[model samples]
Target: MTSEPVTLHLTVGLPGSGKTTLARDLATRTGALRLTPDEWMQPLFGVSDVDGKRDVLEGRLIWTGFRALRGGLSVILDFGCWSPEERWAIRDLAGLAGADFRLHHLWVDEEVRRARCDARWLEVPHETFPMSAADQDRYLAACIPPSADELAYAPIPDPPAGHETWAAWAAWRWPSLPRLDLS
Candidate 1:
């Protein structure tokens, strides 16, 4: 008998909100292929220095996600899908796959986010930085919160009983991956 296909769960959150960290933890647990926007963009075109290139990178990520879904791979997309339009785009892609798609919004307070940013700035490799402070400020400022109407589309609630935290779910899903102390 054919095994059941894996489900895709897209994790969305702003920078410094622990989206990537959570995604990594989830990936390790579930053995799902995690796709971070930065993973695809930085190496190909360098740091997003221009608006045009940033748009191009986003498009490429969307396309790559579509292809991966079609291939029946459970993907965890780690990106700041701050707007309803962007979330809708992801929803449409999930629909096309006929796979269950769940969104996990990494909710964190602004103070926590900024503190994480300051503390982890050096954690990002040199290849990803060197942009001016002005550029970083502009990017942060442009990150608008989701509207009430937009949030109505597909709100990400907490995981169900079998899958609670990343480690809990990961242990249940893929037993082969290395287990981390999430406690």
Candidate 2:
């Protein structure tokens, strides 16, 4: 087996799709580093004020992930990378590090996601709280969620054949790495 254990695993989904929770759980189970956009943004610009800070932090996180992969450490990136360009960037990063890259796209009903976001307002830190009604409406209008068709027909490498859950496939394919828990 190769001494290098690096692999880049990215979780893409809409807000409140359990990306952060899953990423954290995965990090704890595996020895992989977890990077969440919310965690990075909240400290610097606050969640409500992430418009300008997001661009900077996204670059920073991707760069940091690349560095970690070079050091033979796997990384889990929790971000809503709905854009095709963003996904491509991750694919390129994995190639640069010579590490296997896995993409776990979280799929949830729109109503379910919104309800979860509503409930999370009381659970998360004030700085990372959900947007106000007007703000949320505007944000939703401005940003479009990826459609099922988009995910099902992504250009990147498909998840291993016949494997439904990412955790199962990871454990089977990468026995050296601990199983990730998204639930």
Candidate 3:
């Protein structure tokens, strides 16, 4: 058995619940690859989130993360996986790869979360997101905290076979040169 050190770290909580901060810290300490959709959102589309593409982009990241784990590299995804289904899928993936999985749920008071969100810009100007009360409300309403056992996770529909698609590790193959037939 390979004694490779591989871990899958997932953040679970609301936006302002310090997921990113914790993710950053954990990644730094553990030398894990931190994947944050929010960090990519602003630069990619000039907005925090774009219609139709956010989920697709996140899915791609998850695929890449599994690839990393397969290589025995630790991965930290700071996507605030709020649903049991989401968390369960990740946990199952890690188990399949024989990697340690951890779910860090940032429990913060509502008032404190709001304050943190409000102070983000001033506190961390370089990495500020435009968060509104409406956004917070929407996220809270949609969030499904993991319950006891099951990692606060529930069964989610598994992706179809061959669902995890990725580029060949060799990167790409060049087309064979066509032979010139001089008759």
Q: Per-model C-alpha lDDT, please?
A: 0.61, 0.66, 0.71
In the range 117-183, model 1's lDDT, one tens digit per residue, is: 6666567753244434565466567766665644465454333466544333333332332332223
Q: Which pairs, if any, clash in model 2?
A: none
| Candidate 2 worst ten-residue window by lDDT | 173-182
lDDT of 3 by residue, 7-52 (tens): 8999989878999989889887888889998888777786666675
Q: What's the candidate order when arranged by decreasing TM-score?
A: 3, 2, 1
- Predicted structure with the largest TM-score when compared to the true one: 3
Per-residue lDDT of candidate 2, residues 1-183 (tens digit) = 223357788887777788888888778777788887677677767664444556666666766777788788999888767665456546645766777777777767767877788888777675356656676566456555555554454554444567554434434433333333334
Give the candidate order by descending lDDT: 3, 2, 1
Segments in model 1 whose C-alpha atoms lie over 4 Å from true places: 1-5, 127-141, 144-183
RMSD each, Å? 12.9, 11.1, 9.7
CA displacement after TM-score superposition, residue 167 of candidate 3 (Å)? 18
